[model samples]
Target: MQKFFAVVAFAAAFLTAWTAAPDRAEAAASRIKDLAAIEGVRENQLIGYGLVVGLNGTGDSLNNAPFTKQSLQAMMERMGVNTRGANMRTANVAAVMVTANLPPFATQGTRVDVNVSALGDAKSLQGGTLLVTPLLGADGEAYAIAQGALSVGGFVAKGDAASITRGVPTAARIANGALVEREIAFKLGTMSTVRLALRNPDFTTSRRIAMAINDLLGAPAAEPIAPSTVRLSLPPKFNGNIVDLITDIEQLAVEPDLPAKVVIDEATGIIVMGQDVRVSTVAIAQGNLTVTVTEQPEVSQPNPLSQGETVVVPRTQVTVNDDSKKKLAVVKSTVSLRELVDGLNALGVGPRDLITILQAIKAAGALQAEIEVM
Candidate 1:
């Protein structure tokens, strides 16, 4: 109960401060690195099919997963152990899909983390060990060899009639399990131009970024090419050394311009309003109308020892409560987010009630910000 009130207090305080200071909110600065990313300088996804072994009677059934049996047979044949046409029964191996991300500029001999997930009806992979598997990229070429003991975060314990499982027992991860055997060719310093892609697309923010970069370098080397992209050409001094130029620009701070928006999550009754949210002069009246029904059953019996059958008599009580004492409140025109919040909070309404009130206000065209329901 205390935590709930603390959250309410925090929300009220945040609303108060967010609307009380417009200059500070608008001038909030963030580093360029957090707002944008360099093109062609990102991680690539790698995946492969492999097998997990050493499970104690918790692996995929050979009859159910024919691929696992085929893979096992092929592996045995390579090791001079022919198991073809021979009855081979085993519940200690599982077919799995191995996945990992090849980091940017990853060189040979460097290791990357790999994920192993069961592709069949494997009860658990807690004590399994991934065998020698080749991780492939989108180009259908093997790039890394992944082979390590599985590190499952969850486990499963079962009895005759009860079972308990935590997390995902069929999935596991191996840190630094895959060794890089190939590299994607991309020379950042050799490029004369590069693009900075904004994580959130906005023309105002993109323009601010270009202006900030130009002002810092004292040259018009950066330009806003699109609402979500900024083009940067190498200057004379930074030719063949774009890394230093990017490092210098990334540290420069710029305040991003965002649109005024209010997000409403109906499932969780969460309302988030931007600092720029405004409201026109509007009158809002909020009251609760509660109807409660109570059921009471009484037993009716004979007072004497006469022949009688006991019967149940049903009794119900219904009550209606309409808070007619509450009055309507008026919000002035062009009010800040703090004033709007304060006016709504004064109505003694919860978050769910506030959501309905905000929606009604938006429907009446009194809210100036865009409302997004999620």
Candidate 2:
């Protein structure tokens, strides 16, 4: 009877241990659109120097910004007014720098929004109009031209000895203010092969992606060139147009490897940990120490006949409180993420406390992944 009781106890322990282990399928997750990226698609930045007119006496002062004066002089010359070396003071115009992004494969005559910022000491750009300005590319070539009325989302009001200014005083934007004049040269169908670059490169993820592509379209269709790049042969049908091929390839699903990582935002005290994070058996003790100082003022009056001066004295009181006698919590080796979270949560640690704990864990060679703080 004693042997049978011992055997039953052992069996129960074994079953409990087996059930405690986390299921691999439930823990395994492939981030949505995490490993996929478009081939040969990108955005180009376009910039231009322009002027914003129609300001209500809040334009750039010509004395401070000489560039604004020079620009205005040059613009006046084009209109048959030769103002060379002329000291002109105008409060209706403000110098602005215009910027816009040209999307990939943007056709001619397509309109895009442009951002305008005051480059001088303009108090406000409200109700200003941006003149015709030629937008230039990185290669010093004109790509688009911007011209529209400014839509400053702010206002300023002034009265005698008082003024109220609200919103941004230097920046504004114009909707559909730029027109594309040229197309970026990008050949997508000329090559018989194309490369797919992963947004986040992982060896395991790259292998899985290559395998999935090969399985979908035989082994001869796709090959893994490196851990981050996969080369694919263009099918005869897609050789004429590559857009359809990209659309189909991006929809293919593949299981991705979860990276062990811990991210902390120091500004907001946010801590994020991956599911694969594990912790070794360690003891953690947390306590608070506070020191407070207070001051009390006292006044002493002069005696009536002693000719003594009145004086004020300040008294400071200081106190220190330490809570180091709290119980130290011990956590055993955690094999899974849920266990690690549960153990940490049981210690009543907040986000800031968790950040410290993670840093300490990483320093002790227990955390297996990279720690990033932003």
Candidate 3:
């Protein structure tokens, strides 16, 4: 009997893997770095206020958008050109915000890509050249200088009574347009110890990561700092060679743990369950009930000699109907995903109906997974 039960369980598992996760059934060992990242070694955001010029009458209106006019006047004043009384109403300039990411270990004169976005009611930023803009970090310190011709992937044009547009003409990216002016002093390799922060916090995964790192070096060099972090002490042999140590650690593969979950998109009538999801023995009854109400109007007129006024009356019709093909099914506790799904299908429910059934099962404490409603 035990041998027969084992074979049934194996078959159920095989069917579940083959059908549910058709393309990806195998849970292979993933790289340690793919599931975690080193703390404090990240990118920094840089922002700057700049202007995009040379627009073909699609730039911000200086009259309605006084800020654009004021910005232009201030820039001209900085260049020693006195335009205090000049009323600039041309659509050849636009106020924009320049942004870039200062990568860790970046040095002076290193080029980084920048994103330009119009800050005003400009129709578009196409064919515009960004002025000399200094990108600032969170500390309000200038870290990079961005200046180049904008490469707008979209365009907009309005003629007489019609207009044509595509993509987003108000935003653009310039490849290698910003020069790094300051380096963020990140002493990544000089630390006596480094910490790995897990992308997902799990006690089991954290313990496994520590075990994997220790197993690689044949010593207890790593310790679990938290459920989401692991700290490792640099060995004396690896002193001043932190990069080599990190590379080895990243290459080491470990099976990352995933939580059992069922996601339901009620708007699209889509239901998805994780491989580890299960349901206890339960009975489900499902049927559809619909109620429809409609309105009807009628007009009545009396004979002219009778001296009776014409009248209009309103009537409403309502009907209630229940599906006659209701189904009631008993689901047995299944240790395999295939059996669980097969039992649910026996109820003859669609995706939308399955969402309600799953929710009901969760409320009844039969579903052994988290149900995420989206």
Candidate 4:
């Protein structure tokens, strides 16, 4: 009797652990750098207006695009060419806008890639050379200059009847095309405090990140200010230097906690469920009703000797299918994503049908997860 009681107690303990395994598996460890980013360390956008030349009769029509004509004339005047009143009808030049991003802490003389897009009614920008354009930041200050030959990903070839183009011909990119001239002043080492912004904001994730940092530094250096922000005060040993502190804590690993969410793309019939998604006890029935109609037209001819004309006759056939073999399936309470998916699959419905069933379940208060439809 003693041995039997001991065996029963062990089995109960094993069952309890097996039931709680799904909850423990949901919190997977993620690196701190992947969960959050250092505040103020980001890229800035720059934009400029310029001209793309050397197109083979695919440039914008000067008659329709007045801005292109005016810009060309202005450029000619700058080059000491007199075109103020001249009839300049050029089909090899197109007006374009240049754009690029300035990486954080980028110094002078560093080169960055630039994207060139046609601003006029140009058919294609292939084999075009971008002229010198000054890229300006949000402060209306010139930060970089971009000039290079464009590498268009697509081309347009027409023979009066048909044309085949693969990619966007009006947009192009130039690798290492822009040279950084002015620097955006930022002193990273002189900061007293730094904030880490969470990419996916959650209160639990924020607290976990702070705890991870505190464990690594052996001090109360990191504090969660909001769901999305974790501010860190400079410890005494760091001596006003925040770069080393960031470098040390950004590599620590912590488990990020996220809320249970189910995302559904109705257009594409795609469903994504979180690991913690669960459902209450519910019964689901899925079946499709199909009705088919077919038409067959026939002509009836009279005998050769009879004085009767041919008559046309129409025939129609119809069939209905209700999928009577499918029956209602019941899904008990779920504890994991796999169990939930298995329960839904037991209804034998496709993704499109599953989308409707999920919505219905949510309406019935059986789905314990939030449903997001796209």
Candidate 5:
């Protein structure tokens, strides 16, 4: 109850501040690096199939998981163990898939974190150590070698009729486990033009970026080839030091124009609104209806003079609450996100209730923003 009150208080304070917010759309400037990234500068996904060894009798069963048995046989033969006809039955191994993100320009011998998830019905991977496995790229070529002790941060315990589990025990990670053996060489600075890709594509943002760059360099070197990409050519003055030009371009600050948006996470009852969210004068009515049912069992016995036997009686109680006195409150036109939040809060609306009200306002063509449910 105390926590609930605290949340309500926090929401009230947040709304008060939101309704009194300044006009940030005209003055605030965002760094170029935060808004754009150089094209071809991204991470590559690397995955490999490997087997995790050294389990404490909680690994996959041979009879139930044939793939684990086959993988174990293949691994044993590579280590000079001839078991072509031997019936091997061991519960100390698990087949797993190793995954890692190869950061761009990763050099040889540098280690990357690797994630190992069980591909079979392994009871747990808490104490397992991944065997020396070659991590491959999409082209089926080995790019890195991963091998280390797994760090499964959870455990499993079972008892007679009940069991308690915390986190997932079948997935684990190894810090700095995979050694990089390949590199993707990307040519920058030498190209005639570099593309600046905006993380969020907007025409106004693209035009602003181009104009900002043109003003910064005193020339029209930056052009908006597309809403998301800004084409920048090498100026003759900066050809001798193209790296310096790139450095300067990334440091310029420009005021980015963003569309008004509201994001609501229904599962968590979290509501997020952009600074520009506004709503026209509206009225909202909110209430809740709760229904409850209760079951009660009673025992009845026959009197001393009666011929009735003892029996059990079942009883149930149902109650319903109808909130028909919901009051409709008037909300004035709210221009800023703070005002909108404050107005909604005035109606005594929680996150879930606010979601419904905002949707209704949008349907009525009063909400001047996009509503996204997540």
Candidate 6:
């Protein structure tokens, strides 16, 4: 009877430890918009083909990049000059594709950064100047113009046979190189209602956001349109300007709801477990195998030097070692994160091995949360 009571006490103690809360603070719940959202504002992509000149002999050759020569000829023709049969020798210029992001509501003369990447076989774009390039938007309309000295964060040098290079040779960037010539039209105050789009859609979080906004501004102001969108009616205070209303609403803090999930990074062998992850009763076993190979050299000497050459013989040795498999551990049902970790750790498995084991367990439907490998 005493032994039975002691066993029961031990089991109770173990259960208590397994169910204990973690030391880390619980993540505060936040609105879907607070966690992730589209702020009704975004940047547009701009692209242009341009020439990078003033290179130190590292530019594309004229024979290899005929497009550069053609572009130069065309530009000269546009300036009321004719170069139909011009024989151009290009050794200090390269053809490049320039790209930039035009920010939302960008006004005229607003300067933006531009990225330039070599489109030809140029060794490097270091110390180059980008000529005036007209940047076009998705609508095929010229929206901005970019022209500045490139800030290539790399260097390249070469001799007759060998070359030394650092950083990326084909890409360079210019700070505040592109000036906005046009802006995208968007009227925030004209709409009777506005929609707030959540970056990450979660039903619980969406509902919380609607409730928080409604509680603050009253029920007649905010309503949930869907799990990912919240439609709000403009109140009298914000009737003239909705931009200020949105700015104020976005600053309101609310707890966010997250789905139970386990994210594993295969490249870095990182395992992240969510709080709500659970495990069913299961058995696990782990072991390792190692193979080793060695080479031995044997020398043979000529006997009395009777026109015989000394030879060497090579001998190869290989061995395989398999470690004893660990004892199978039985995980109980409804196992918490701590219990699951402890159970896996008991098998003396490393992170890489645990990843495969967790995958198998998830496939077997023993892990309750979603498993994601990145």
Q: List per-prediction Cα lDDT, in the order shown.
A: 0.91, 0.79, 0.86, 0.89, 0.85, 0.81
Which lDDT tens digits does candidate 5 get at residues 132-241? 88988888888899999999988899899988787999999999999999987876657778889999998889889999889889999999988898988778888655
Q: Which stretches of candidate 1 lie over 4 Å from their true place?
A: 1-6, 15-27, 301-311
Identify the runs in model 6 with alpha carbons over 4 angstroms from their true place.
1-27, 30-33, 36-40, 80-82, 306-312
lDDT winner among the candidates?
A: 1
Give one digit per residue, the lDDT tens place, for model 3 in 1-374.
35433543464566665766544514556889898999888999999999999999889999888888998999999999989997677899999988899998899999999999999989999899999999999999999999999999998878899999999999999999999999999887778788899998888888889999999998888899898999988877786677778988998878777789998877766666777898888888999899999989889899879999889888889999998677668887865677676776666666667778899999999999999998
Show where candidate 3 strays beyond 4 Å.
1-26, 293-319
The TM-scores of all predictions, comma-separated, are: 0.92, 0.86, 0.86, 0.89, 0.89, 0.86
Candidates 5 and 6: which is better by lDDT?
5
* Pairs of residues at least 3 apart in sequence or in different chains that clash in candidate 3: none
lDDT of 1 by residue, 1-374 (tens): 35444665799887666556668844588999999999889999999999999999999999999999999999989999989998768999999999999999999999999999999899999899999999999999989999999999999999999999999999999999999999999999788899999998999999999999999889999999899999998888876688889999998888888888999987877788887899889998988999999999999998687888899999999999999888889999988777777788888888888889999999999999899999
| Regions more than 4 Å wrong, model 2 | 1-34, 157-165, 237-240
Tens digit of per-residue lDDT, candidate 2, span 102-195: 9988999999899999999989998899999999999989999999988887788889999988888678988999999999988875667777
- Provide the global lDDT of candidate 2 against the true structure: 0.79
RMSD of each: 2.4, 9.4, 6.6, 8.9, 2.8, 7.8
lDDT of 4 by residue, 1-374 (tens): 35433533464455456557765544467889999998999999999999999999999999999999999999989999989888878899999999999999999999999999999899999999999999999999999999999999998888888988879999999999999999999899999898999999999999999998998889999999999999999998987899989889888888888798989887766677776788988888888999999999899999999999999899999999999888788888875666666666666666778789989999999888899988
Among these predictions, the greatest TM-score belongs to 1
Q: Could you tell me how far off, in angstroms, the CA of residue 70 lies in candidate 5 after the best superposition?
A: 1.3
lDDT of 6: 0.81
Q: What 10-residue stretch in candidate 3 is worst by lDDT?
A: 1-10
C-alpha RMSD of candidate 3: 6.6
Tell me how many clashing residue pairs each candidate has.
0, 0, 0, 0, 3, 5
